[model samples]
Target chain A: MIKKVLIAEDHESVNISVEKTLEELGMTQTDYVYYCDDALARIQKGVQDDQSYDLLITDLSFIKDSRVQKISGGLELIPAVRQVQPDLRIIVFSVSCIPSTIEMLFGQSDIDGYVCKGRNDAKALKEAIETVAKNQRYFPRHLTQKIRQKNVHDFTEYDIKIITLLANGMRQKDIPAYLIEEGTKPAGLSSIEKRLNYIKETLEFTKNEQLIAFCKDMGII
Target chain B: MIKKVLIAEDHESVNISVEKTLEELGMTQTDYVYYCDDALARIQKGVQDDQSYDLLITDLSFIKDSRVQKISGGLELIPAVRQVQPDLRIIVFSVSCIPSTIEMLFGQSDIDGYVCKGRNDAKALKEAIETVAKNQRYFPRHLTQKIRQKNVHDFTEYDIKIITLLANGMRQKDIPAYLIEEGTKPAGLSSIEKRLNYIKETLEFTKNEQLIAFCKDMGII
Candidate 1:
């Protein structure tokens, strides 16, 4: 039932909440640590005692509170901990809802779950822990559509510039002039239309408003 | 002692949860609407009938359903509703916890509370509703430090470039040449030093590491 959990977060308030959450989930043997170095050490010691932790919950950004440690943030600490305990389940509990950042984390690490620590976090965290315990990854339902849109078409600066301009009430034909003035490559109306068409086709949208709205909703613009 | 409340959120699940939260807060007269236009209309009717709502809870983003409306998102709706019923209390409950976005909302509107609609949202919303009822502004405790840091030093694209470079392991002395290569203005070493010094002094940090860490923690870098 995915027992022993190690929580690596600096905030005492967050720690208390997470601990309470763990208790509710029936995972009683949870260890809390503020520093990543200490968290790693706890895992190592657990391994040595032949009682390794089943999961590790961490926050991406850690405050450098007078503690000089080898690992700085949760991102760095993940890779380091994986080297020592490759089988350890990881869930990122942080404030960043940036699609690219979440995409990067899932791309870079073997994170089992991610729950943003605001709003209905306890419920989300409970869902994440349960899902991860069943050996499945938990992507936020609210952001899955946006993240899926991300996978469908990667946005370049050129595409963003075009969309952003359109969002700002720029005429479609006038985009080429702005691109040319900005020294952007393929500074042609055909190129802009083609680029936008590619996105429309990928997203299966018939109208320009739909295209713009989709990008805006997904934070691509 | 705020009693009568109106909620404007598109998602049914979110509405249910928010309704429950309001119910728990002893607010019995809670009305839910899925569109911003309807929310505005309700407020207008409330005023005309002399049965005014005490508070309005809204989500920043609303899905464009089959209805054509003057007000689109909660942000636009806030101002429109304010014009109709200027004395109504407002609490923005959304998934956006972005510091600058919150700052802009506070700058643009007389919003009484802003609670992010994610993990711990019910609790945050309860706090927000209670706080706003007593005629107080409720800012998220976690993001307040970052927002205050924002008021202390506004970061421009140039400042972001320098800090991002430093965060990426670039040397302090090498920043000028990099900025020059990128064709950024005021790309001299002295300008870079002065900018860094200004930020450091404003944030009350003596060392570059402290400045960098503070920026990183605040998501400015």
Candidate 2:
């Protein structure tokens, strides 16, 4: 049973809804802050007083104001808060649905949960909180499937090199010449074409551009 | 001198900064609302009372809340507010930098100005407000240049057809075959290649995928 939770969301409406959702779970000892800096401060103060929060739910983006904030966004605040209290569970509550971003949060940041701020998000948040409370990770089912799909298709170094070149405006025919000049293996045009085709076929992408866009979106390149 | 202005921004910090900007301009009569529905209601009520606002500044995306709103976002609110108050100097204040979206707002929506919420956005907002007050349209210099570039290109029906097909996963080599079957003119592969080369040259793009992505971003296909 999670006792104390701190929410850092810039939107007042979202903050109110998150608080209400926490209350509905019969967990009333919730604190909220509108800025990332303020949230970090509260976490630090709580840790110093030996009254640390159990969970930290935060939004990624925050609109800049007149006051300068050292910890401007949630990405920076997560690590900052983690430094003070490594055991505190963190849940990212945001509207951003970028798969690559979500992947980074899960894989690199080691966040306990992610609840997208979409329709019926309050329900999602409740489930996320419950799961995190049990020391389990929670991610939206669709995103989980996407992460699984991404993991299954482990891109090779050659695949990444070609895709990066394509994304940087290198033509397919020109790619082999560039690769050959760089002394990369299998640098023939035929090899390049076959590799792109195979990668696209594996990804179920009909166009090379789609493959490129997907790579860019996934931050693979 | 603009007497009254209404700002519709969901973020409290942005709303405050906009208010401060207005105050700096010596225009004290400013009202702020966090919801599009509330902003529209204020505009409608003002119109009904014959004490209408001189200017309206709004952000396109709004964080959804528990309360159902008829005018959920600023895009819907723009036209609705325009219907009631056509003379209201409307300025889109947003972080969205998509050329297509901004182009539509300016070209189709007949908005008076647009100020992107980037670095020095407050200064931009002030300039936008001042320009709109003088019954002149305002857009960021970069956006204006992009609009000019788009105007210069003037994509033809054939151009759109080819780009649309490319965007839809059709290979350039296969495009002519599809075009010929569809009874399209100049359906030869040579002609298609020539047209593509010409478009790429005109757009200064090195790759067909770059051209395709650019077209998609500009909403040309």
Candidate 3:
């Protein structure tokens, strides 16, 4: 049972959110600190006091404060805390949706979960906590991609054109109309659908938006 | 004497925080809608019923829902609502700190205020509301930099290196130490300070972090 948790977010509103979510999950012994140095000190104090926290939820970037500290960002804080309390379940709460940065965190920092801060962040936080408590790693459900997918196809100019249109807010169904109007080949709806499906499989993506975001991450479009 | 207020935000926790802030400021008639369309509808309904809201606080990015909406984003909703009721005071509460986008919102959408969502957002919202009530425009104070500063300098390779180091989380004081270790010329703290201050002045940025962020936005680092 993950009862004691430490939240290392700077935003008061975000802290209120995480607190509310933790309360809903029946966990009340949660402590919060806004600074990375302060978070490290709290974790150290907790371990020394024999009241070690079970989980650590932190933001990647803490706004710069007046005081200078060696452990500046959450990236610095995570490894330092791991040295002090290796078993602490850690989840990053940040606005960064960059997959490469997130993948690096999971690999290097060994965080237990990650939840992007946004519209359904509270719901995502609840799910992340529940999932992490079950000894499984959690990633944002909507933004998750098959990063392990190495089945790369040499993307043609036409494929890039279609994906670029999709990225520019053109509806998936409306792509064929634009292509047809532009006098591009395979402008039929069925052809567009088949091509998109093939691209999705090549990238191992389950949704069009995920494919778009991946293309953005890889600078493909 | 701003009385009735409407909050358009998707996050439940953010709504609670906003509602709580409103309550603390002695406003109980504040209504919250999770969608941009719902917010516009409420405003329209209020006008017809002769009970128009005095202020509208909205997030720029609303989460996508099941039903498709004609007014997809806050940018679209603002102008549409402006046509219906030109006197309605509007405040944007968004995660975007981009100065150019905010400047455009003020110029095009005629929004009364802009508050960045972050560590001090709740406090910033309070200040923005108080300031806007006086018939003034509100921009996030900490992030404010003169966007009209047209003075351009051909930045040297050394300048980019310094700003990049700052952006990479090196404290200004520690910068000289790193530069000295690298055998870079003018590695003294005073020389670094003088150069940084000159850059800030050139960019019309009052803070080092602002200078770093501006360099990032311009792709100079």
Q: Which candidate should be chosen as best, given DockQ against the real structure?
A: 2
Off by over 4 Å in 3: A65-69, A98-104, A134-136, A143-221, B1-3, B10-12, B26-35, B49-51, B61-72, B98-109, B131-139, B143-221
What DockQ results do all the predictions give, each relative to the true complex? 0.04, 0.15, 0.11
Clashing pairs in 2: none
Question: Candidate 1, which segments miss by more than 4 Å at Cα?
Answer: A4-52, A57-74, A92-108, A114-128, A137-221, B5-52, B57-72, B92-108, B114-131, B136-221
By lDDT: ranked, best first? 2, 3, 1
Task: Name the docking class for model 2.
Answer: incorrect
- DockQ of candidate 3 is 0.11
* TM-score preference between candidates 1 and 3, better one: 3
Give the CA lDDT, 0 to 100, for residue A166 in model 1. 67
Model 1, A1-221: lDDT tens digits are: 69999999865446656777788889999999888899999999998899999999998876664569888888788988888888999999976565665776787787888887544676788899999999999998877887676555766667777876765556778878888898998988898899888977876665454555455444454
Interface RMSD, prediction 2: 7.4
lDDT by residue (B1-221, candidate 2, tens digit) is 58999989876646766787788888999998888999999999999999999989998878777778888787789999989998888899876665666777788788988887645677788888888878888978877677666644657778888877876677878988898899999999899889989888877778877776555444354
Off by over 4 Å in 2: A1-101, A104-158, A180-195, A213-221, B1-85, B94-108, B130-136, B142-164, B171-195, B215-221
TM-score of each: 0.47, 0.53, 0.61
Locate the minimum summed-lDDT window of 10 residues in model 2 chain B: B212-221
lDDT for A107 (candidate 3): 81
**lDDT of model 1, residue A214:** 50
Model 2 lDDT tens row, A25-74: 88899998878889999999999999999999998877676778998788
